[model samples]
Target chain A: MKARVTVTLKTGILDPQGKAIEGALKSLGVAGIASVRQGKVFDIELAGADPAQAEAALKDAADKLLANTVIENYNIEVRS
Target chain B: MKARVTVTLKTGILDPQGKAIEGALKSLGVAGIASVRQGKVFDIELAGADPAQAEAALKDAADKLLANTVIENYNIEVRS
Candidate 1:
């Protein structure tokens, strides 16, 4: 089974790294960019075929370690 | 317009951060684990609704600033 978790900053949060990227993009002549918000992607290979169990484990992992829930939000998807 | 850029390290590359996270997850009692790899996600808001143009701009942005193409591979998706 394969699982992916995406963690992103919540709205109204200041993202300096994203700002830096946006500025860098403009300087590189890549126009049409208004804003950029950066986040994290985690790809995991699990040992089971049970989607429900895998999703539960991944959600727990996201809550416990993968994300800082106060400042960021995380979503999980499992594929078998 | 909206675009998403996913940047991930290529295979065989040394990812110390990902290794550390894997160890952390193990310590946190996240079982059924085989392996973990960490990457980056960028959510971009563009000024134009043209999906093709937005996709091109985001791909350029990812190539130039969002990702180090030498060690990383980036995927770009544009949504209108």
Candidate 2:
């Protein structure tokens, strides 16, 4: 099974890196870009793991280590 | 218009951050895992932009700034 985890900043949180990217894009003349926000993607390969069990484990992993719960939200997707 | 750019390291490139995460997961008792890879995701909002044009611009941005063409590959998705 393969799973993916995406972690993103909460709506109200400030993202300096994203701001920097947006500014860079504008400077580079990539026109019409209004905003840019950055986040993380984690691709995981699991061996001999059931989809449901992997999803549950990944959720736990996200909650415990992959995300800063106070400032970030994480989404997990499992594919067989 | 909204777009997403996902940048990932090339297959042969070394990813210390991902290795560290894998170690941490193992230490934290995350079982049944094979490997872990990490990447970046950017959420972009374009104002009054046509879908095809936005996608092209995004691809340009990814090539010039969002991704290091030598070591990373990026996928751009533009949604209406």
For each candidate, what's the DockQ?
0.93, 0.87
Off by over 4 Å in 1: none
Tens-digit per-residue lDDT, B1-80, candidate 2: 98889999999999999999999999999887678899999999988668888888898899889999999989998889
Candidate 1: pairs in clash: none
Worst 10-residue lDDT window, candidate 2 chain B: B47-56
Instruction: Specify the CAPRI tier of model 1.
Output: high
- Deviation in angstroms for B74 in model 1? 1.0
Per-prediction TM-score, chain A only? 0.96, 0.95
User: What is the interface RMSD, in angstroms, for predicted model 1?
Assistant: 0.6
DockQ for candidate 2, C-alpha atoms: 0.87
Residue B51, model 2: lDDT of 88
Clashing pairs in 2: none
Clashes of 2: 0
TM-score of every model versus the real structure:
0.96, 0.96
